[model samples]
Target chain A: MKAKHQRLVLALFALAGVAGAGVLAASALRDEAAYFRTPVEIRDGKASVGEPMRLGGMVAANSIRRQSDGLTINFVATDGKASVPVEFKGIVPDLFAEESGMVADGRLRGDGTFVADRILAKHDERYMPPQMGEMPKNMKAPATT
Target chain B: MHAYANPTRFLAIAKPLTPWLLGVGLLLLLVGGWAGLTQVPGDYKQGETARILYVHVPAAWLGMGGWTALAVAGLVQLVWRHPLSGIAARAIAVPGMLFTALCLATGSIWGRPTWGTWWEWDGRMTSMLVLLFLYAGFIALTNGDEGQRQGGALSRGAAIYAIVGAINIPIINRSVVWWNSLHQGPSITLRGSSIDGALLWPLGLTLLGFSLLFGAMVLMRMRRIIADNRVAARLRRLADDEGI
Candidate 1:
């Protein structure tokens, strides 16, 4: 075949392959795009249940419970405004603890429970979380004693 | 683009720019590394591990950016059949693959202490791995010994591969958001960065430094390839004169 004709044929084949792969990828991403939401959003009915999503908040203090199976655990994640109960069947991340920020990826059940398949703990670039007990001087009340 | 297609003109610009870029890049990289290691405070949760972000983010940016550059060059080669465009794409592959590998290694190291595992088959990690494999395939196909086969057909074939492989670049970028990934969501956005201002400064510097380094490497490689091609053509002409 002439070189020009051969080049045209090759170009056409390449374009067709790219188009086909793009279509496949777009369809795959549609089901995979999981949006993130906080417990407050879940409490306010702003987040949809039964869809894959991420829940981000702090682990509520004294709310973690482990079952006899050892692998199953339950905890409550709170954002100071609201909270969501989370259930998981695997080992929690080493850094997961009460009052620490975390995110869980899974589907929310109709019963208002989040069943997480995976959990990720978030860390801030500071030596300590802003001293939780210290109220700023601006927010302190005038002496009433 | 055609205005700079002439090799002599391109070299005139690139020759002086290469050393300046390399010097600035090395200086900024040292400063950025110093700030990340000493000046930035340790994380409340992650402690010193957070500093890895300084190196990791820049590497990841270049990994994706390099492929984008390759795709653009490939597009030019295909549409205009411009001679230098293939050289640009060829120059990009080696360093681009190196950065992708670096990103993956740093991410794994960071993940070990933070996530309690060295690797996870999550969307973001998996897609980046695929990008690295695509780079390897392109390098092998383009640079492999083809004894006496002309560069035209091979370069056109490689350009097609480069363009096709570009489909992975976006997927790597969006993987964390598009799937339930262990990797965190993007910390930097057009409006602002989620990272603290102090840390962001070092990260921005490192990203600029790495990009400059990438540019310098590509220019250097293209220059060497051009020189090599000239010598080979001269040898071929000499052989023809000998009537063998």
Candidate 2:
């Protein structure tokens, strides 16, 4: 094998090395690479507009207000310290709800409302699930005020 | 490229080059590893899970990258009957396939804490999974029959697959942003990009290291291909003369 041909191959592969790095770096820079934010993180204005974020907070008492439109409903979710108003414009799950501990996902609307597309009902220690284990140290819910 | 078709000759030369390539690969890997592990900070939002980004992001980066290398190499071998290219393709296959698997796995693990689920059938995640299957298919095609190992045929199949896969890659990548889905929107993008510099540098370096590691491995595998060819040809010639 000629040294020249070998050199050419080496150079080409090396160039590919550079190209791969460029693609990764470029995407990471764009934040196209996503990671999720928790309730605390979401409240800090940490999630991007389209980035799917999960927030868990309690349903503020009497904050549930269903609109006449049937689909669009307004609810306020709070972590006690801060509260974010949410608007859901879709068929909510039967368990759909509000409270500091309920988690929701979707885009935060321009009107400072969390336009939730999905909702999750959380369970605490006293409310043990059938398949779930006993509450772990970290998952032990915060004492209710 | 044909000049180095002889395995022994390729070996003699590549053997010398091996140490140097290996050294460089290691250096880049370590440097990138160090940079990613040390330099990147906890995310302003995710806290510690943000640390996973340095590793998870690059793993995904290299996953796509390794396939591109294999598919391209296959194309070259098919078009030109370049034995070296075939070896390069095969050599890259394992690494590429492994990284793709790693990317998907890591992405899911990252998803659990953030998305609250271990899996989602979102466009990006699903497409990346398909890419992993493609890599496996290429590996399966190359194994077993030496007759099936013709550099031309093997590569042609791979090349076709690669090109098709590349088209899907962008669609998978853009799926979260393009359509309403559970996946997170791109934090890093073409313009108006916004990520902390602390995260970017290390993440970038990790990618460099991963790419370098791939090149070094490809070069090593090419040398092995040359050796196998030499032995295979000699055996064939002896059998022909005996006419047994």
- Each model's lDDT comes to 0.78, 0.62
What lDDT tens digits, residue by residue, belong to model 1 across residues B1-244? 6787777798899999999999999989999889878887765456677888888989998999999998877777776677788778888989999999999999999987787668866778888999999999988888844411233223667778888888888788777666755677777666555565655677778888898999999999988777776677788889999987
Worst window of 10 by summed lDDT in candidate 2 chain A = A123-132
Give me the candidate number with maximum lDDT: 1
Candidate 2 ranges with C-alpha deviation above 4 Å = A1-145, B1-13, B146-158, B190-193, B241-243
Cα lDDT of candidate 1 equals 0.78
Q: How good is the docking of model 2, as DockQ?
A: 0.04
The per-prediction i-RMS, to one decimal, reads: 9.4, 14.7
Supply DockQ values for each candidate.
0.17, 0.04
lDDT of 2 at B52: 67
TM-score per model (chain B): 0.95, 0.83
